[model samples]
Each structure stands twice: as structure tokens, then as C-alpha cells.
Target: MTAQNEVTFRLTRCRRSVPRTRALAHAVLGEWGMSQDVLEVAELVLSELVTNALRVPVPSDRQVGVRIARPLEDGLLRLEVSDAGAGRPEVRAPGDEETGGRGLLLVEALAHRWGVEERAGGIGKTVWVELKAPDIVPEPVGREIAAAMVRPGYRLRARGEWRVVVSVRSEQCDAGYSAVVLGLDEGPALRVQAVEPLVVRQCEDVMSAAIQLEIAP
Candidate 1:
């Protein structure tokens, strides 16, 4: 059975939280079997969030919180940093020569989406960013599209056979490749360099589910 990918850590509000949470993230993400590219970005994003949490003006009794989870189960990795501080974070456009105020800038550029949310207790807030796993590769055949055609339930023809697309997700596949999820088992997922001609159809019966997203700039 595949292990569930989720982790949470509460670190001291001191400066050491920066490196401590980063180490934890490294261990947890490695165990979750993330690729090197995904791991590199995860570490960078984790470090930035932890650094920001440590800088927040929280009381001495409160500790900084960090949560990492594959909430979507569709290749989306979420990294969150929480603090019981009064300040709400916002991205500031720093001048070219400025010394600071560019953390969220990197976050926005690397993450697919990001946002801030009030903690359940209402005294704190969690800053989060979702990073898409590097899996989906755009097939090079007819349409020069960047995304895959996901029609749930119906089997699609590819590589001279028909197979079901159990799930659809956006991934960071390089320019000319197609991401194929063979199945949920220990089988290998293929990133075929090119896709053969096939008829693509929309999933008519599957109603589009509206997800409550909290993406911010």
C-alpha cells in the first residue's frame, strides 16, 4: 500500500526554526518519493516560509507551525507556514536595488498558486503555496497544447491500446513529452516523448467540480 503523504511540525519561534523546519521538510518529502526537481523547490519554498514565520511578532509562548500535504492527491504539494502574529503577509514590489521584501516574490514565481488563510482559532494565519509535481508532459502531435486532455471514466486510445485516465493533473513536464499514469500500483508511469494520433473527447457525464481555491498573487 502507498503511504499517505502528509506532515506537520511545530517549531520554536526562535531563528533556529528556519533550518530546523527545512531539515524536517527534506526528510518528509524524501520519504514521500518526490523527484529531485520537486525536492529542490520544496526545500526553497519551505525555507522561505519558515524564515518568514520566525520573523513574525508572535508571543514567546507560541511556536511557529508548518504543514505539508498532498491535499489534491493529483500531484499538488502544499506548503504552509503559520504564526500567531498580528501582521498579515502581502507581496510587495521591491525596488531593484532593495535589500529585502522579495521572499513572496520567489514564492509567487515558483508556486502554481499561493494564499494566506486565518487559522481556525482566528488568532493566527497560515501562508500557503501549492507546487505542481513535475510529471505532465505535453504531447507533440497535432495540437500544441501545454496541458493533457482529461476525460474521466472513458478510456482513451494511446500507444496502440485503450486505457482509463483515472486522474488528471497539471505537472511540469518538459516542452515535448506526455505524462502517463499507468495505474495506482507499483507500475511505472511513462513520460512518452511523443504521442500518436488519437481522438480526444470531453468527459460529458462528469460534472466539473468547483474547488474552493484560495490562490493569491
Candidate 2:
């Protein structure tokens, strides 16, 4: 597979995603014909990365992204977990009998090479790990679809009021389409879109309000 060949999962931020991250990596690596030992280590590495990623302070509706990639002509399997979050990870000395705080330390032990890189647009950073790939031929697969950033923050009527956009990525669907997933202060979030009539109605509201203010006696 080429360097361009990669798969990304946009994840919902929650405790349930810890297992979901492992499952997604297992499925993708299994399809690539990776060995059991390699799969196990990759899963462990990913679990730690995902756990720490969820710790970052991000909005409930914001998503974390995980990407699996193999660079062209490189014998390394790369795993990356990205989020629109703030924080640079650093290994700390865990005291004896310490119950936790050894996430990055485990990454260093398992990964051949690991580091942090600034994500595009400088909105966040990606923590990555590279492992030696077993001598196995990958199954034939096509490249994942490319998506463009549509909005930095899409304001829409969600949760019975207007709120900031959680995510907005424009993807091709025989032509073009986009969707929004918003979070509410309480209860479950909703998925909505701006259709033709909604667009026209909003324009009408804007005009009426602007003209109404001008009609003072």
C-alpha cells in the first residue's frame, strides 16, 4: 500500500470509545494480514493513546480521530490518534506503588518510534507510533475518501437553541453533501441540516427584522 493509503475513524468522546478504538484497529490490521503478536502490541499501544486522548479537554460534541497508515516503501506500521485538543504529552517518573500515570511510558516501551506533531491549521496535535510490520502481504484495498474542512464552527439551532458546530466536514457523495452533529447541555445530541426552505425562511427573518427596525414612527 502507498503512503496515501490510510483509514481514519472520527470517534465520539466517551468511555465507550476505549474499546471501540481497539476494535477498529484490530479490524483494520486484521484485514491487512498482520500477525497476532503484532496485532496485540498495536492494540495495547492504541489503547493507551486513546485513553490519554480522551483526557484532553474538548467539547462533548468534538471528536477525536485515529488514523492507521503504512508509508510507501516503508516497513513500519504507523498509528496516529488526533484530536482538536490542547496538551503535549510527556513521560513522567511514576513512583513505586503508583497506581497510574504510566501511559506514555508504555508507548515508549512498545513502539519503535513515537513522537508528537502539530496537526494542520495548528488547531491541535497528533501523537503517533510506528511499529515494525511483519513480512506479510496486505490485501488489495482502495484509498479512503478525502474530506475537506467545511467549517471551523458551524452555528445552528440545536438543543432547542443555537449552539456552536461540533464538526463539519464536506464529503463527496456522487456530488457533495455535509451534515452536523451537535451537543446539548442536557440529554442526547441531534443531527440536523439546513435545507432549502430553512435557508429561505432564515433569509426572510433577517430581512423582516432589518426592515422592521427601520419602520419606527
Candidate 3:
């Protein structure tokens, strides 16, 4: 089933937090099966937001909060950065002589929509942006797992029809066998057991596989 997945980070106010936030965002969004294009844009957005938050002139001990979420139903990726310091972030027009101050401008250009919100209790504000997310892709099926070329986001023939792979899982069974569970684009879940030691290797951006797997009667 498709659901909203989110992760938040509390970072110390410092220059190092900028790169650290980018790395954390890459790992989280990568694990969520985001495409490379999405990953790149999200990392850039996170960098700008986190950098802006760190620049807020709050107390040294106060921390900056960063949140990354993908709401499957909305088909958009949401990014938020909250700072204990006051003032809303504004997009600026930088002249040719200006060396900086164009972060929010880049954000405004790339983000589908963005705005600021007052934090709870009115102690600070949260800057949030949303980007259009790619459609959800289903997981690899049983035959694909057995072939060891499990590619997510690729279509495969199953039950006499083509379906995308949304999620994939493999578990070692007793003896020399493994069990694989795949969630398809539709509501059906594919379960298979392979006796010949399975080695699942992931390949990104591959074409649809013509291999067919039959569902149990």
C-alpha cells in the first residue's frame, strides 16, 4: 500500500550542518526509491533551506529542524526547515555585483510551491517547499527475483498482464531456498519461493522485462 513516508532531522547551527543535511537527505530519499533526478533536486533544496536556517541569529544552543516527506497520495515531495530565530524568509533579486543572497530565488524557481509558516507557540517559523514527485512504481516479481535482475520502476508481465514493481523483499528460508514478496501496481501482492539460491541484484532505469510469472489458482 502507498503511504506517506517522512523523516526529520535536528541539526546544530553550524557550517558543517549544510553538507551533513544534504547527505542525510540523499540517504533517506534514495531509500524511498526516488529517481536520480528527484534526489538531485531534493538535495539542492535541502541544502538551501538548511543553510538559511543555520544563518538565523538564534541562540547558539538552539537547533534547526529539517523535515523531508513524500505523500504518495499527493504525488509531491515536501521539504521543511524550522528555525528558532524570528523572521520569514523572502526571495531576493540579486544583481550582477552581488556575491550571494540568491538562495530563496533558486528555491522559488525550482519548487512547485513554497511558503513560510509560524511555528507552534510562535517562537519561530518554518520554511516549506513542495516539488512534483514521480509516479509510484511497484516492486519486482518472483521471476524477476529468481533471475537476479530486480529492477524497481520497471514494468513486468505477471498473471497475463503488465504491472509495475512497487516494492520488493527477499527472505532466506530453511534449507537452500529464499522467499520473495513483491507489491504490484494494482492491489495484488506477488509471493514466490525459489529453491535455487537467489541472488537479487538491482538495476536502475532498465526497460520492461518480458518474463512472465503465473499466479496461484
Root-mean-square deviation per candidate:
16.2, 17.2, 10.4
Error of 1 at 108 (Å): 0.5
Question: How many steric overlaps does candidate 1 have?
Answer: 1
Per-candidate Cα lDDT values, in order, are 0.65, 0.67, 0.74
Candidate 1 global lDDT? 0.65
Clashes of each: 1, 0, 6
Q: Write the per-residue lDDT of candidate 3 for residues 1-217, one digit (tens) a residue.
A: 2212677879998899999998888887777778899889989998999988888888999999999887646678899999998878888998999998999999999999999999987899999999888653333333333522444555555665556777766666565566666777896877666333332322453326534433222
- Pitting candidate 2 against candidate 3, the one with the higher TM-score is 3
Displacement of the residue 93 alpha carbon in candidate 2, Å: 1.7
Q: Tens digit of lDDT per residue, candidate 2, span 1-217?
A: 1112477888889999989989988887876778899999999999999898888998888788899886665678899999888879999889999988999999999999999999997988999999998554533332211112112233333333334444443222333444333343344655433221111112122332322111111
* Model 3: residue 166 alpha-carbon error in angstroms: 19
Question: All candidates' TM-scores?
Answer: 0.59, 0.61, 0.62
Best by lDDT: 3
Off by over 4 Å in 1: 1-3, 134-217
Those runs of model 2 whose alpha carbons end farther than 4 Å from true positions after fitting are: 1-4, 136-217
- Clash count for candidate 3 is 6
